[model samples]
Target: MTPIGEENRGPGLDERITGALVGAAVGDALGGPVEGYSPDQITDRHGGRVHGIVGPWHGDDWRTARPIAPYHKGDGHVTDDTLMTHALVRVYARVRDHLDAYAVADHLVPDLMTNPRWIPELEAEALPLHRVFLAEKWLVARLAYGHVDPREAGVGNIVNCGAAMYMAPVGLVNAADPAGAYAEALDVAGAHQSSYGREAAAVFAAAVAAATAPGATPDSVVTACLSLAKDGTRAAIEKVCEVAGGHGDFES
Candidate 1:
């Protein structure tokens, strides 16, 4: 292994970590309303810009869109993405060191269970994940009740982006050690995801850790992601960027 981005000379470690967390939160809130919309749809709506928090989509989009439970998320209401992130942060704060699947079961499961917060998407304050969404509720159930092994828990879960979507904090915590971050995230995410979701989570953590490197720039970050990402994830990103680039909107 090349040790991924495990270099110590990277500058502004604290700033990079903070940026990653805050950026994820802010971006989640901003993108929440537009989550289901396509790029063209987003452009047509919101005047091509989400200047601030807005309500759910309107008009035909609303009629055609998948049913969102108890609409009216209001401005800046966060979804399970941010909620999972905060739970992970609390776990890190308590452990104050590296984590594995057991730590995820002991700390993260409890955090998701007892820590009640306003779930804007669900429009209710309740236990995490499953209570938030039946699909997500599996995370807590498997670890807390089913007593499954954390490392293998994700084996049957849906193959989606749910795991990868909330994995940036692991990358930030591991900082320059992309490999370590990827390993830990893979372990932690196993309780909630499987297949492509698990793969994406590991790659996302690696990318974040890689970006936290000293003197890291935008191009360098993309390079790191391409390097660390494997198989489908790597090829998908390259192809998407290349295709998206043709439209001159890859950055959008």
Candidate 2:
């Protein structure tokens, strides 16, 4: 295998980085409104598969809606996913090096608590902490307030994608280096996730790293993820691929 930064076979580094970042933000915005809806629900609500940006699920009642109230979810608004992605980028900028749990404690937690930015969903500028869900809030609660060890801070939190959602930057930083990305993500996500949640974060980062590699293909990325993934994460991806293998058309 080519060394991480030594490969020069596919898109240039600049292009790959730009594509990954822009793609993540765009995808996040597109998925915001239909985030928790079932496929059939999304299709029904959009009058078909969503082809472009749409309005909040409850339209004018968005502010008073029962479940998603007080936050606008669509019309190009990004959810916490993109907010955390941007925060990871800022952490990368400040550190100028690979990050770990300590970096989360020293940089990311502070940023979420102190930085007030334009929250599209909120349609207002506010601290990221205000918009992030309770899972993310665990970071500040555990690290800044509880003063738990960064590496073990995620122990009692719910196991979910709170860490994985923003891990694209880890993959990008470790571009072309799936193994490195997986290891680094394990360390970084340790501050925010545990069990399969952390495993998913590591695997997703590896998948991104593999995708950014020179001459990478979808199959290659999947192979890299399968190789590094563990427990239910591996089984779930395998099952998805197995089920998908029977269908060639995504729109069917």
Candidate 3:
């Protein structure tokens, strides 16, 4: 196993882990308020591109706002994405070992269900369960209530990004080892996702793992993703990269 704090001639593993986790939280906070809107819509609503932290979409009435009601999704507040990421970090801290589906059942589910933590989006202290989206709630339902085996719990849930969204930790734990990250993420994600969703989690973990390697670059990360990704996931990434190659910048 790769040492947790190994430094392979670039930033130390600890630094990479901090960068990845902090970056994920910041991006989540920035994106949460405009999550469902298109880029054009967001630009129009914000009177231009969002360049920094902004307020709730509905301002003072955010508590009663439709669609985003009750959740204060802006002003540097992180949505459940960051919350799940932190939860996964705690899981790793407690386990002190690589995790799999059973680990999610034994540790993650209980953490979500029993713990009352400060939830930024809710602007109050509450159980993580209350803030979790439906797909995530499936973890508790299947394992805690439905008595489903952890490895198979994800079989019938809607194929979505729930598992992939917070999988950076898996990649971090398996730093510089994209293949290891891919395999481990597949096992861990089996508790929450299947089919394309499961595959996406693994591929995303691999991308992060690849990025942590010494001298890794965007091209290298994409190469790692292509090497490990499969089926529609692979085709989709290839198409995106192909289309992206024609553009000079995001604004194009």
What are the models' TM-scores?
0.81, 0.92, 0.93
Q: Which stretches of candidate 2 lie over 4 Å from their true place?
A: 1-10, 246-252
Name the weakest run of 10 consecutive residues (lDDT summed) in model 1.
243-252
Per TM-score, the best of the predicted structures is 3
Clashing pairs in 1: 10-214, 11-214, 130-137
Positional deviation of residue 228's Cα in model 1 after best superposition, in angstroms: 2.3
Which residue runs of candidate 1 sit more than 4 Å off their true CA positions? 1-11, 49-51, 58-66, 120-125, 244-252
Candidate 1 whole-model C-alpha lDDT, 0 to 1: 0.76
Q: 2 or 3, which is superior by TM-score?
A: 3
Worst 10 residues of 3 by lDDT: 243-252
lDDT of 3: 0.91
Q: Give the per-residue Cα lDDT of candidate 1 at 165.
A: 78
Clashes per candidate (backbone, < 3 Å): 3, 0, 0
Error of 3 at 205 (Å): 0.6
Candidate 2 local Cα displacement, residue 164, angstroms: 0.8
For model 1 the local lDDT of residue 180 reads 86
lDDT of 2: 0.91
lDDT of 1 by residue, 1-252 (tens): 535675555547887888888888888888887887788988887777777877777532442455754544436767777888888888888999988778888888788777777766666676675445554677777888899988887778778887887788899888878888888888888777887788889888988998898777666656666666778877787786677564222331
Question: lDDT per model, in order?
Answer: 0.76, 0.91, 0.91
